[model samples]
Target: MTAFCATGAFAADYVPGELVVRIPPGGNVQAIHDAWGTQTLEQLSLRSYVVTPPAGVNVEDCDQWLDADSNVESADPNWITESPEAKSAIIIVAIGSSTTQYTDQGAFARIGLAEAHQYSTGQGVRIALLDTGIDPSHPVFQGKLIAGYDFVDDDADPSEIATGVDEDGDGLTDEGFGHGTMVAGVIAASVPDAEILPIRVLDDEGSGTLASLIRGIDYAVSRGAQIINMSVGLAFESEPLENAVSDAEDAGALLVAAAGNENTPTEIYPASFGQVLSVTALDSNDVKASFSSYNEEVDVAAPGDGIYSTYPGGTYARGSGTSFAAPFVTGAAALLFSAGTPGEPGDLAQSLTDSVVVVDSLAGNAPFAGNLGQGRLDVESALTGYLAEQATSVDGAFRPYGVQFFASPNPFRGATTIRLSTPAGTTMPHELEIYSLQGRRVRTIRSDSSDRGAWEWNGLDDRGRHVSAGVYLIRSNAGSLQSVGRLVHIR
Candidate 1:
């Protein structure tokens, strides 16, 4: 058996004598195998399959031969990938304890998560987490997980388990254990209400093949995941992987990946793809971490050093790597979806880039300048700015609400006029209240007489303090009549 290497200086190490091929619809798999003298190994998806060439046929030759066949759409070697934090040690802080105490970690404050939560907790978004399996029973994931599968073991349960053997030759057994739990923990911490779909692509050793990763992507899309978080990456690009990413994007799912941990300009697969939101890591000082890969492909940065999150066995730990950094962006995307920011994946990606905190001028980051991406993530700014932009671009259609309730001059900088119309001959007292997107009541106005229906809000809360600029909801109740309308406030 001959080894296959990808086309690059830092080529990816792939399996020997194995090829992943895609067959067009209605193509005869048996005929292709008979013509090429190959054996079918596994069916990855409806149109993709894993096959082994006949004895003495090199992987490269088999790939070329399959590509030339009329039935085959594409063929490539099944490349290998690893978790970014596969070798890093995790410092376990607490076990079987309430997760509320650790919610105030520095990473949360650095990214303005507390402020961001005031707008949205990712109520209606589902994130597909593809990594080493997760601890399904972890306290942080209570009521946060949806149905998922384990491609490695070909099972329905995608739970993390410890294997005693050392897979990476690092003299430590199960170094990759708890990796998925940590990644899931980060997302749960950022968006407590967002549902997570845990797809186990990598094993406990943090090693997975391109075939499994592709299958995981297909599963996530089939399960209706809005965002896919991939903390694992290949050293070199593969056509099969890129095709999977394109399919996911076409299905309206946003892909977020770690930039890799080689600390070089070399691009990594999936992350290097233009459709993906490639994320790098930053320390507490707002500078790039020493081990994070950086280049023009990086889309954003997040706190990844000494980051604390959920661990296996219902515990919590602190670790660092670009793997953890990618989930922060994933969580932020969930927030945008929950806040009703309407658009495709590209629009959401633009919103995130436009709201980043430019760290080029920060100390210790002068060397990386444009290579570190837009900057460290600021979740609050991303949500508010996106909401405001959406508000201004619309025709102010009252599709979401009834015609009896509406706001004029939406996207107003200072204040806007709100009007509520009641049925004729109604004499019950009416009450109108303003609320943030997260459902926090901001102001309340009451009319004792039924003759009045218009009120001008000065963008102040009940305490008479000015609220920050963002989207707001106006709800009114008059006995049995209730109406809801949306408005935008700009600073």
Candidate 2:
């Protein structure tokens, strides 16, 4: 067996003398091994196996040889991927006060998370976070985590731990520790109600092989993950990894990945794949970060500079990289899924791309205009536009009201004007009712005067008390006149 190195500098791009291969469903494994002078090391799946070639056979040559065999479905070297975060980019800060409460960080406000939350908090959605694992016991993840597996250690507990040595020779031990926790924290801050499934693929040195990544993705899909967040990247493309991505997409899971932080136009695998939603990093001013990679493959940009999020030992830290930027897009996806956005993952991705706040016109991003993707993420716009589109698509064939009913500033904080448009000769008394999502009527506005065409809602209940922020349904029924509209109230 080839010895694997624990240090990043000594690690090879692909495992020597080892190949990941997929055989026909019922192919004879022994016969194929004998023909190729190779031995199966381990079976990854029913059709896939990690095999070692005979002593003198060159690994790359054997890979090509095996790939040409009709019995072999696919074969390739086991490529390695590393966590995209740079050690210097991270700044860990100890939580000074034990009573420090969890709140949305500045990045949240920059991405319009508060307004987005008024629409959907990602309730019932599951995000599979594939990284170096997480500090599961952290206060930030307290009721927000689900059962996860650690492919690195082949264990059930996917918690972050230090190796006590600087494997990367960067003078910092466990440099990648708490990386998963921070990524999870970003998702939690965006959608606190979303369930995070922490799958540990990368080791403490922030390095993992393509084999582990493929397995992790399969496990996430099998566990019913609605969204998968991969904050890791590899420079070279791997066929098996792409296959796994395709499988995940086919099973209805949306994959979001970080465009590597190399500050170059070079594409990174998984992120460069057409199926995945590639994310780039943006600074507080909406300018692209210095370390963030920009390419045509990037799907969207998000605030990643000095991102404050959860760390190990019940503390919070600030970090920066495309690694952190990817989660914001993941969180946005969860929010859309939770709000019952209809359609496949592709449709949802398009919706998000369409809703981006265009940053290309900004002076800071002028040089990289078309390479930065559609623009920076705007969660509020994504949700609001989706809701509006849904409202417009509703079956409006039957017009009982003989008028059009709508609201200006549909998602309002204090008040919104409900407008009713009718034909010049048409005048009818209407009673507008406001009900919570649970179908309980909260307030009623009666219009006995036919001349009135609009009414203002002060975001108050029928008892003249303020109602909690949430989605509300507005319906008007006067004899045969009936119309319904949706309203989002924010506090």
Candidate 3:
């Protein structure tokens, strides 16, 4: 059996000549190994084992034996994986925190920090950041970053390493070197009081195997992290990786991940997992970034373009990608955690969704809105949106409002179906009107006695021309009773 380690930043892909075997629960581990002529290299858990073939045997032979074994639930080669290469596109125009180079605009201001800070500074909340490691001495993360395991070097030092090579071929070598630091900086800037648990899964070359990522997830859960931010991702799917994410969510961690920077719809692991809150990126114009990958799994959008944050050596630099956007939500989740919000990750996700002010341009016209999770991340609104939702009226009045109105694909890109439901057989004058947030009536979506039916809005106004991207209010009236719901339209 051979132990593998990369010597340089650009080391040969070390495909471990071993297998990760997950035995059925309560299955006899000794019996299974005895039948396969393999010896356990490490016991990840009672049911999960990393095993290697005998000295003279072929690895494929051992795999065949395990595949045919009824006692083995799942077994496969311990595949070598790497961080999403697109993050190498992170363009750093200037470095260091010097007043001349640094923009005064803080990362917090982009996401409405003034209002969010009033509610929570993420005090007492712990967020686990899984990335290439972090610089321990960065001022922004001085007391907040708690070092976890270094899966690469297998040591206590989780410092970010640079291979001095453009691992992702973006013309910049070691572009991912201080990636973790930047991500941590974003979280710190958003929630200065929140605790950060840094986990080093990727190596100096911005590559890590599935095992490392899974280990990081397990550690994040065990360390009592309320939020786990995965700024890195792998393109291929791995069962073990998916299971680890699920386990983290089950253990009460709000898992957030980058949606990848390939600018394609292809899903990246962990982020693509159902348990994770996949985040996309937006530019200064509040428009979807051309490089931000979009898909159905995207949960929320955040400012990722030209984001300035802390870097190594007591400096700061600007970077961009979904990798940066994810931490915004992570910081936001830390606020929810610090507030002791009731419910699991799903509830937290829903709260963030409801809070978004809505980037209407992401509606039906662009393919990044409805299909991509919910909407943009409104940190302040998220902190207060839940309470506001519970109260039907601003004064907390419980009026008997009769009709129920809802807009499907609320943050729609092209068109949406609005449904107005009322008590059956108690028909009154039914009307559905679409109005801009500015109080101007755009169109009358419906005006009939039909209590329950679906009406389509082709993203146009009464003038029959497509309206500009913005929030639209749907008002439903039956007799003297009225109900209102919000619909977001995007170009």
Candidate 4:
């Protein structure tokens, strides 16, 4: 393996309990277009989300993730300033490049996921591609597409015509490039057995209004789509859209969103919402994508740089952005869901995070502690982990609130950090108190205004005094809400 350069980020080892976070993508529509040109989400994001996992996973392929000539280090300067923490090793896109006709790598190439093929390509699963409209006759969709409704015109034949068959008498086909067709190819194409529900939410401009996305979400839920891949996201997070996603989650559907390529920590929605799994892209190294979002909004990472996949007009092209990486995670999720793994969206979410293997350590991936949350998605590993965890029944009391917490560099030397979440717009003061193992209160820190979405603390007492090396507890209080986390201070 090639030597990896250090980015001062620690390697996020693949621990079974760790959550697979696909953070590190651009934040929203504007940012995504800023990363790429003016492209639509349903095409860029959903197509990747709906596709199937590659034939197999392997260490050698992971090695390619680190190669300088690999996807992560392409010509796109959007992330040139950002580097993967691991060495030449990296988390590569398991599937072939769209430039390669989005075809399956020969049997010899898919050695990474040797056992993955044993499972189905989610053939029977129905993934509704809500974008412009699909070319129903695409070779990949030979027999995989199902009858879909074009809400834009309320038409039965929802083709990507100059105007979609205005299903709702809106006299508009929605706005978008030929994205629906691309997205359908990713999902149903990869999993030939999987069926597609093509719903056009946008017009021909490759853009759609907020209302259109909400309606599209509702449409997918009604169609019994086990996996609804939403590759597009808005610049601003809307409460109405979030509520619709909440309903989708309640309806036993998996919604995959693309983390925008903003090159900062800004988060895009519905991917950044409380429960949604926001996916980011990685070159070979397991590092926080420079254009990817951070600050806990991201849940996992996948391959997105210089990604090759199916394009319009039966062509293939290579593109970069978090939009491409989302499908890998979505495909993995579909595979797991089809396998009948049991759990709530949260549990399934956790298992998915725990299932992937950190592939980037060679291409300077050691320092990205949480950049590529839970590393790259490993088909067999994720499936295996999901099945194993399924056997272990619920062990703890259920968490009533949707917030989550974490402590990085757990057994810390200089400083141990703790982060807390209490949703957005909470009208209450929160505090994080530190106590010694003996239950003695040593320090008290309150959640100031900076605790917008979540709060964090480096292992220290109220007086800015570092504590002794031992076990401690961080008690979180958000007005009426309370939670606790065990802390271990080292050195």
Candidate 5:
């Protein structure tokens, strides 16, 4: 391996002990570390490693040394920065002892979630909240939260702590103490039953390193998170950060991030990544929030101005920013996932983009129209539109809300593959039973023990007799959940 000097901030000289580096695929990270006379600290992913150099070495020299080897992608200092906690303007309404109703306010009805709630409550969906720790004891999250890890404190208690120290040196102390709890509240409002997994990537001051963010992503994916809500982002580009986002997407988890509140189109990590669904903020008037960042990467918009949601200490507060806007989409996606919606991540994302109602107030306004994404989120429209599409299929069957098992090449010449989309890391006994339209069992097939399993059918009855060319019903039974789909067989 040969090192290639990377330009920019890496060119600066600084005393360094630890660094984050990405090694080439299938290469020995340990051997590479030994060649550089460094000790391995941890492995972020299969190809990403954290190592520290021997005494008297600077970060700039280490970059140059690692760049000389061809097995390295890029090596940079273990850079630390606050999660994009930059909100353009925040109107914080203190929570007193008088509030009881949190989601009954205008934000719920404005986004059309009140109507959407009748259909799905985001049950059985696991959403990973990557931000400041959450207060799980809050009544709104009484039975909604799952145990999550705290990367900042390296403990199991992922609860928000109050520290008056300005860890980010932003001239503020504990600015992000209750940020994660608020984000979780917005999601609950839309998908009240979705399981909230609070992964604390940011500290009490709302500050953390890129390495910590990467660790949070790794943890979320391993735990089978269907949707990851990152109400945080980084300003500058980092290869390690980008690679982590790609890893999450490849694992079949949907990534959602908040567009910066800097009021500029400047891109932010994870949010800018192609695999992530970036969200911008909007106000109750159905207009773009004055502070939401405008960019080509923005995929959807949600209410962010003066949004009312759950706060720490078992109270409700009104806050505003793109940070709060993102959970609405997260919750909406969770609702679909829990309903056993079948489609790739991109397919699900397209459903949302198509369901957005174009606003006349913002259309042709050039700036807002071009950058505010399709339009503000309408959960009722998105869910109704998705199910409506399913009902109009070839078989005219309704597969409403349940487990999803569908087959391709329905009009099969001889055989077809049935794909099952289950919750991540789920392994259970299931069988695919094919039957004639007249209710005679044709063939029974079993799926592999994995979240995503597949099986094939050969148009034959249990006696190995070729059934007459006709339509067949394929039903997938997994414990208490079952889904029915149609198939056409021709002789």
Candidate 6:
């Protein structure tokens, strides 16, 4: 277990995408697939940059194990080990990595000052992060945050996010900085009932590689993060990032991502993936943010620009961008999951987007109507559906009175059949568009006829490929008539 000081970024730049481990690792014949790594320990590294060992194939006797972080953590069963024949596997979660709340007398939230006191009030859940480790001495997080893994080099304490000491020789985080600290506050604040994981995915200077994201996501899922909010994004997609998302999905966790401030329809990775919930920004008027991207590739929209949230030092900020919107949904999701909802992340996404309030016409207001999604988020309505079950009106011809869609399989598996109909006899030749949860148009099962009827996706996309396990849509159209029905693709 040599204290390897990793200075450079991961050999591979991380982007979010599908994780596929075509082959299994050695010794662990049951090791079917790793949501975060393909090669298991060979690909996984601890904060100390130490190689992890395969499950049941313990490296306690190996020299690398001896050199790893003295407090290095491992998944309970180690997802990198075997397959219990689970369609959706279990994973560890790193909620609020450290909820010690060291800043406010041992129990204080770091952001969302307006709701600061309510941060951990009654979450009954946890807030996990991966940034400047926590100050266990802080009262708010002390005795909270439960447990976490320190990925920083040479540091026995996983709580230290920025240390003036480069004890491990890693060139990063020589000084104390708070990146994940702010992120944790956004998700955990105004909800004292939740916990914080502080997984430490990023180092000081707001920079991280795919390796850390993978390890952090894996650790969080394993620890049980039902709502994993990522207030971050990358330019391109990476295999490791994709695997991280997959792992979280397997654990039935929602990966809430920031839609980016690029202000263009072209998307950012991870948030642009099919499994994620891409949140855009909408002002108080329910208008799309100028910086928010718009295109057919966006799923949902939320209050982003000029939004406020928690930061380090117990202070609040008026931070803007889709980064904060991701948390609105993340926190709401936590509320739902803790209250017995948000079952599968893939489905949670559809629930949030399809039922969102259609105010000010997000499509008409934004530069690109397709990317802005369904206007703004209505927390109570979104979670419990105050208006979901009741739409404005379907009228004759199944025309979209405001913004309502149709789908199949209330709780279906792969290839759930879907059929949409108009108000008896509406004829339209519009294409049937199928968009993934992340807003990417995956399969367009065209309805060549100009009449109402049924069309089968066969659970396959236009690319002739079978998508992952999650929620999907079968958008119907017949000239002026349109409807969006929800579907599920199971393995």
TM-score leaderboard ranking: 1, 2, 5, 3, 4, 6
Give the C-alpha lDDT of model 5: 0.74
Candidate closest to the true structure, highest TM-score: 1
Give the residue spans of candidate 4 off by over 4 A.
1-101, 105-114, 161-176, 284-291, 359-371, 389-491
Per-residue lDDT tens digits for candidate 3, residues 128-225, read: 98988999987677788776879778888898887787664547677567788888888887887888898998876566766677778888888899
Q: List candidate 3 segments past 4 Å from native.
A: 1-14, 53-67, 85-88, 99-107, 163-172, 360-365, 387-491
Pairs in steric clash, model 2: none
Q: Whose lDDT is greatest here?
A: 1
lDDT of 1 at 318: 78
Tens-digit lDDT track of model 2 for 1-491: 11121224323567777777766657766766878778898776656677886567665655546645666766666766788874234445556424333364677777799988887887778999999999988887899999999988989999997888877666767778878988998999988889999999988878787778888998999899999999887786666677678889989999999998888897887998999999999999999998889999999999988887888888887788999899999999888777643469998898889999999999999888888999999999998777666444121643644656778786677999887666556554466788876678999987646447677899999999998655677776544556677777766
lDDT digits (tens) for residues 16-36 of candidate 5: 466777777777777776676
Model 2 clash number? 0
Cα displacement (Å) at residue 456, model 3: 51
User: Against the hidden reference, what TM-scores do the models get?
Assistant: 0.82, 0.79, 0.71, 0.53, 0.77, 0.53
C-alpha RMSD of each candidate structure in angstroms = 6.4, 5.9, 13.2, 22.6, 11.2, 17.5
> How far in Å is the alpha carbon of 159 misplaced in model 6?
4.5
Candidate 5's clash total is 9
Candidate 3 has what TM-score? 0.71
Q: How do the residues 132-179 of candidate 4 rate in per-residue lDDT, one tens digit apiece?
A: 667776566667788887755667776765545543342444323445
